[model samples]
Target: MGKAIELNQVDTIYEGEKIPSLKNITLHVDKGEFIAVIGPNGAGKTTLLETIMGLLESKRGEVKVLGKQLNGNGSNIRKLVGYVPQEYSIDDLTPFLVSDVVLMGRYGKIGLLKPITKNDKTVAKKMMEYLGISELSNRPIGKLSGGQAQKVMIARSLAKEPEIILMDEPFSNLDFEARREVSEKLTHLHKTKNMTFVIVIHDIASIPKVCNRVIVMDSGKIVADGKKEDILKPELLEMGYKGIAC
Candidate 1:
């Protein structure tokens, strides 16, 4: 019922970089909140999410997620948070099957050393159905197209049964129809399960209609945060970005 994530004046720097990738970022996300983070290239959108997940160690200030501090043994906290990265590399001929990839999502909850149980497989298959990819279960993952592969990744994340899901540029590879479908799917999950979502996206057109809050970032700083309608003002396009927000 409290904040799901909190960051206070946090600064994150990449090794060998003169300037921090994230600067003075402060944010609090409530439980069950759906947030859209949109910005032009070079914004710290990715860095901000990474910092909250302890992927980017904070150079200064504090970060707490689900009541756990960012520093020290964050594995337990990570198990509660699902992250779908921007890109993952796999050989075009990789032998891994779609089911295999999705099944790995359960490894966190099932534990690294334990064998997967029947319940785990059931959950993974349900996730596949939710993503409309159940037919691909036996197919080789590398055989799928860009949009199909993205759905597989999302299903994989959901198999973990995470309380909060963080997605980065999830709609980048999808066609317009695919993007809208996936957006609606996310909205359904949020509505039914009260799931918390913070998605980093470039295309404003793809922002799920269910998202009530939006955060805008530029030059490693959060330039604006408020109701989705208020933050997407026309003038926002003039700041940092060159083309349409979508």
Candidate 2:
């Protein structure tokens, strides 16, 4: 399979910081691969996702997605890659309803000036239903609970009909039952849609069963990358958690 994402000796540094948040990172994700990126806090897991989505430009080296360079074509590339960021600050009085927020995801594909078509609404509705949030379509987004809001974000990402999905701590706000339900839905989507996924999750137990590969990061670098079975070995995990790269 072709690579869906590639980072070659990449170094991403935030402004005003001397040290790069991501250091000498080299990785490749094959199309349709379901991957779990696990690491401790400050391990650069979030940075990796943002860098791949081209939200943060690499200070050195090359970053490519779907065979295109990220430097010159980030906006176009991002439209095909759905991203659910870790946090969003929505004012309680923002006045946007859940349905409106979800439909906003399609604005990139449908064009900002074009009217929303029947097909766009259908896609957005289906995504909300699949995510078990159809009942919240008319609810004000800022009034929803944390878990409810998270589901809306997930639905919005799915509504984009993206070829790849990058999610950061997607289940963090969910309760046990909601987490299980969402995990099952994601697994089904991965199997049926052949969409590539790169999920950064802190809880190893919550990693989806459909995830075939595991990436371990520490100190802004990839310490290990391999099959889930190999990477999840007790000894290996212990080392990885302790900041020792394999």
Clashing pairs in 1: none
Model 2 Cα lDDT, one tens digit per residue, 1-246 = 899998999999998999999999999999999999998899999999999988898999999899889756478778889999997988898799999999988986766788999999999999999999999999999999999999999999999998899999999999878888999888888889989999998877777878899999999999999998888878546656422111
* All-Cα superposition RMSD per candidate: 3.4, 4.3
> TM-score of model 1 relative to the true fold?
0.92
lDDT of 1 at 18: 88
Q: Which stretches of candidate 1 lie over 4 Å from their true place?
A: 71-73, 235-246
lDDT of 1 by residue, 20-131 (tens): 9898989999999999998898898888888877777888999888888865756666788888888787678999999999999999777788999999999999999999
Off by over 4 Å in 2: 71-73, 235-246
Best lDDT among the predictions, by candidate number: 2
Model 2, clash count?
A: 0
Query: What is the clash tally of candidate 1?
Result: 0
lDDT of each: 0.87, 0.89
RMSD (CA, Å), candidate 2 to true, equals 4.3
> Against the hidden reference, what TM-scores do the models get?
0.92, 0.93
Error of 1 at 90 (Å): 2.0
